[model samples]
Target: MIVARELPVHPQASFFGAGPYPARRAAIAAAAVLAGFVLTAIWSAPFVDSVIGDSVANGLLGYDAKATPIGGVLAGTLFAFVSGLAGSFTACNIAAFGAVAPLVGGQAGEKRRFATTLKPLGWIAAGMLTVSVVYGVIVALVGTRMPQFSTAQTTRLSPRSVQSMIAFGVVGLVFLLLGLIALGLLRGPGFLRRHPAAPLVLMGALIGGFLIGRPYPLFRIMFRSAAEQHNVLYGAAAFALQSVGNIVVMAVLFLILTHATGGRVQRWLAAKPARIATVTGAALLVGGTFTLLYWDVRVLGRLGIIWFPMISW
Candidate 1:
């Protein structure tokens, strides 16, 4: 008979195992997320101003700013999806994703690793979606009660179409420039190339805050439509749908980039990070240019200039 030897297991090796260190880490992550939410709350009131501005602009243009249930949901879903995709490609997320990829894809086999990678990502997505929707609801409730924002009067909100148009044009230009930077066609900040080892929980909170933060001009525009309605539940539902759309896209990205079979692709992407960034940037540039052109045509038409085939979609 032969004696068999067993390998020794370290207590700190597994996060799920019983240990004070793992518990402490978990507590820290939770505290970090809560802190992020509190910071967002502090900025909520200022964001309401943007909401009012957007609503006034739409009303001046003879567009109904009040959001219907179905329309709000649809609009939220589309815009948030785009926002989430763009956010994921940002420096913070890219760094987090790169740091976690190896662990996600390092399981015993290809099939197992892919499945394992999705589990944590799904959890993070759910957490982000839940937190963001809660924040949206809070904004809707607080903004609706404010005296100035209670009514949807275009005159009260300000009927300056020129200013609004200029603002949109500027926004378009900024996105276009950022996109160019991503593509490497234009020089970008060097910090983007660095990968930081941030905790997953902290990253989740950051993502949640980004998607729902009222200070972000783009989100303020999207929220303004819902805010004009002054219905808390409706606004929350709209934002929830938006978060769902964002989460879905994030899941797909996780599936592709961190799967076990994606090692070769990952290596290729790593070797040409600038090239990948460039492609993403170009897409943003095209989108921004289109938006500017659309608005320019609309403004010119309003001024009695003849323009063929007005684009309203």
Candidate 2:
């Protein structure tokens, strides 16, 4: 029988702190989640895509991708990819930045900057591709769409509101559980803890799944076009690229961090198991709480279930 060796402790500092203290870690996690909830209730934190998304759309595409005339196969595909890139920082997908914490840290005995940066990203891409392609293909086959495109209300809640809640709720739960496990508050499957790649893949899946509930104007345009086309290959390819575009910025940042430092910073931080836990835990908690609170609390407030400050005003 082989016994697993303990990770070596590194002496350093990071935004998440390199020290190991359960009490402090728990407090930080709680605070981060609380902030997520508050910001979400107020305005879904990062849903303000118009500012950035529109700017990108106009700057590059020469017109607002929102409800603009998208022509030609090439135009449709480019619009899909660009629109996705535009919303990369929206509340719908912002939480994905957390995966950077784990990816920044090199795997045990893996120190090459190139491998360290690309390997986990590859795994994440695989996960994202799986979800996005399947979703797109399903859209092609069923010709169905989210109720967000409609202006109808169902009693206390609009169908679009309910749809948003359901889609984001599921993904939020996944993030919550992952955060708990990372914080050691919950004991998940042994393999999840044993294999670092597992959580990263899961992260990517959740990020890709963001599209399922996205109500952004630009994305809605893309969705409408893709659905109408009824082309399986186009839908799959389009969604796959969209998913890639979603993470392109973060992935680039990760690459720069790893390559710039030649993996030294990553090594120093990832060297300590405790620091890795801290960063990963904080990220998951914030993302989970934000997704759930933004979609549910905000929507429910609009439905009169609960009072939200922003909604009241």
Candidate 3:
């Protein structure tokens, strides 16, 4: 019989003092958290483009993308928030969850209600919420200011429009490729394999980057349409609400981990990497396929070979 070898522990991997320089490791985690926000802010512009471009490149609602400003913004935020809940269970987020689970969940081995862990909970949740809100705002600010164009405008198959279609297709493939990584079918570069330690900025950035670039259907659906409209308020509001939802859901997970001691939840999370990868992978694959085929459907509609009813938002 073949025996499976256990993975050796890295000094940097231990959250508690079992490893050498435990204090420094904790400090590094804290620093990474803060650094995550800085990176998210710095990369906001390009991130926005990548996200919004994915939407625009896919078919958008045209004039309806701007339909009712007030209602749209409110609805967009609400919907995005709901969507974020589902989107949170990915590798990047799982890393974030694991990173802070020890601190927030505490050293207590007893499993208790989440209310008991409110002290550490407050700080961690607040910071996460704040960073997420900032990320949403940045995306909105950039998305609204981007050049005006729409799927409706691309009905004509001119050279410039053809080029645009090609770009969108390329991005769709990129999303698909990323989905493969999320699903564990592909490995990331070795350096990125390290679990983000604190000041948690890098962890936050990873979450932000994953959320922004993961080709989640909700993001592509909500932001893409909003980006085409150039509605700053809607864009910002939508992202803010989405972030709020994500933070709340993730906070609940943290609380569960902290209070439900004995590390049952954490261990379960760690043990099931294949399942997590599969779920996230499937979602991205479907989303990427939809994004890529958007133009093809639009072209077919333009040719009047197959007519489909427009979605009422």
Top candidate on lDDT is 2
lDDT of each: 0.42, 0.73, 0.43
Task: Give a tens-digit lDDT track for model 2, residues 170-263.
Answer: 9888887777666667666766555656766777888889888888778887777778788888888778878888898889888877678665
Predicted structure with the largest TM-score when compared to the true one: 2
Error of 3 at 215 (Å): 1.5
Candidates sorted on TM-score, descending: 2, 3, 1
Q: Which 10 consecutive residues of model 2 have the lowest summed lDDT?
A: 10-19
Backbone steric clashes in candidate 2, count? 1
Give the TM-scores of the predictions, in the order they appear: 0.40, 0.85, 0.41
**Candidate 3 residue lDDT tens string, 1-313:** 9997634232122221222222232333334334333332233322333344333422332323323332455556665665555445422232334334334323232344556456444544444555555655565666644322223344455442454346445544544554444444455444434532332333343344334433444555666656654666666566655555545556666665545556665344344333333333343344444434443343354457566333321
Q: Itemize residue pairs with steric clashes in candidate 1.
A: 179-281, 182-277, 182-278, 183-278
> Which ten-residue region of model 3 has the weakest summed lDDT?
11-20
